[model samples]
Target: MAVRTQVKFYYDVLSPYAWFGFEALCRYQKPWDLDLQLRPINLGKIKKESGNISPGPCADVFKGSLFFPDVQRTSEMMELPYKPLKDFEESVFIKGSLPTQKTLAACQILYPDNMEELTRQSWLGLYSHDMDMTDKGNILQFAEAAQIPDVDKLLEFSVGNEAKQQLISNTTEALESKCFGAPWFMVTNPKTGRREKFFGQDRVEMLGWVLGKEYVGHHPSQ
Candidate 1:
């Protein structure tokens, strides 16, 4: 039997592009036969180390140039929600780290046991509910919406020092893995443990290629 490939998904909530890519991954899960390994890393630290900033003039150029159009095309294709720039509440923290970490802890709480529902609920909480996932109350609310029975314990674990350390460790590992941005996907050979990585939200077809699937081509319409 061929060992299944595990793909690592690193996400930050601030990026709308990441949300689109995540939806694509979820939609194609069974079709692609993937074992997704979700890891949440602090994009703020990554940006500080790399000297990057969000919502600058460069983002405007990028939005007009490639990123926005790419996501728009994919969103249309997948029939998923696409908002160019929603009025998300801005935080002093860089690029939605705290909330993403909380979600990751929640995933850890629910994985291997409630994998399917947890994955669905996580995505819903992320892309649909528009919750400030950084807040404990918001997470508890998401837990309730998901009908996850162990909401309190998950929230407690999410707020603990251990969760902080896990985020740090996950960030360090992603950096060590040579990722410099959000929504990084890596395919690991379960047999040899060799890993190949692709960065950004626009690499969905590339991921399919890595998994030996004929992905539909996507391009921004002129």
Candidate 2:
């Protein structure tokens, strides 16, 4: 039996870059044995701990101005579907930790297999369709759209103390691991006992290199 390389992906829905990274990972064709472990995290808490405030509000006056355009360019370059939310800065705010917490709750019940679809739909719902996932009603609607079973039960569990704690634990674990942002990846080669950390959707090629896979830049033919 071949040993599988493990890739741990830490993400939050607040970051468009994380959404891009998630899409890439989902479409990635494994050239070698691999296992992905997806962990939902709260980027706001990570930013608070790292003293990094979001630049979205003041992006026009700062280097942050380049952020969104760059993301757009990257998405185009990679041929990934992307549609920026209307009134992006004003519309896309995390009301609370409820969104991330709900992700963790869903993971607890449907993880190790169902998370990718859940996350993909969630991202598309928020960014592309302008769905307000922060609201419970919207979340249930999203669950229904994604075909997640037991919507009522999941929503109840999501707001429970255990789900909150799980989100906290994941956030703490991410911070302790020196993660300061979303779309963080930790790749481990069990056979060689080697591990590497990568941040950003841009690091996908580097990750491929680490995994001993050829980095084929995006092509129109693909």
Candidate 3:
């Protein structure tokens, strides 16, 4: 039997770019014969540890103007649903994503089998449906959408110290791995036994090249 290639995707749900990358990876996982691992990390922690500054959706006047148009075109090309968060300031800045990030980590810890689906639903709840992910009700809804075995238990666990610590651990792992952004891709070269890191959304074709798979832009199976 052939060994499936391994790919680890590190993402924060705060970025729409991560949403696009997540969807693309999900669509391509089967055809690429990948052992895709989904990892959720805190983006704010990553930036502080890496001493890197990330430009937000409307970080400033100049780049902010281009952010949405690019988002629209990319989402259309990738065929994933895209919507500006209904409350961008609250979601991205004030309320923060700690609780949501912990819930995602909890899902991975308890339901590794449904990690991808759970991440997808979690992102959809925030990005596509405009649901406030910091709310426990919405987090449980994401678990339900993913068909997790016990969502009430999952929600309860998400707030505990265990889940909070798990997120910190995941963030530290990303930093130690030299990650500075969401949607970071770490692919293991099967033949060489080396791990290659690719950061951000536009590296899908580059990943294809590294993995020896055909590149046709974003995953077309979406």
* lDDT per residue (tens digit) for residues 88-161 in model 1: 33432333547546556555644434434454455556555555556667666666766666767766677777
Looking at model 3, the pairs that clash are none
Candidate 3, 70-160: lDDT as tens digits: 8889888877777877768788877777777888889888989988888888888877888886788888788889999998888888889
- Itemize residue pairs with steric clashes in candidate 1: none
| Residue 142 error, candidate 1, Å | 1.6
Clash count list over all predictions: 0, 0, 0
Each model's lDDT:
0.63, 0.72, 0.83
- Model 1 alpha-carbon drift over 4 Å, by segment: 53-73, 84-100, 109-129, 190-193, 216-222
Better of 1 and 2 by TM-score: 2
Give per-residue CA lDDT, model 2, range 1-222, as digits (tens): 778778888888777888878767655636544587778887778888978666564444575678778878987876767777666655555354356456555565554365666777777777777766677777766667666666677777787777777777778888888997888988887767888888888787787777777666654126
Q: After superposition, how far is residue 42 of candidate 2 from its true place, in Å?
A: 0.9
Model 3: lDDT of residue 166: 86
- As a TM-score, model 3 comes out at 0.94
Question: Which of the two candidates, 2 or 3, achieves a greater lDDT against the reference?
Answer: 3
Point out the higher-scoring one by TM-score: 1 or 3. Answer: 3
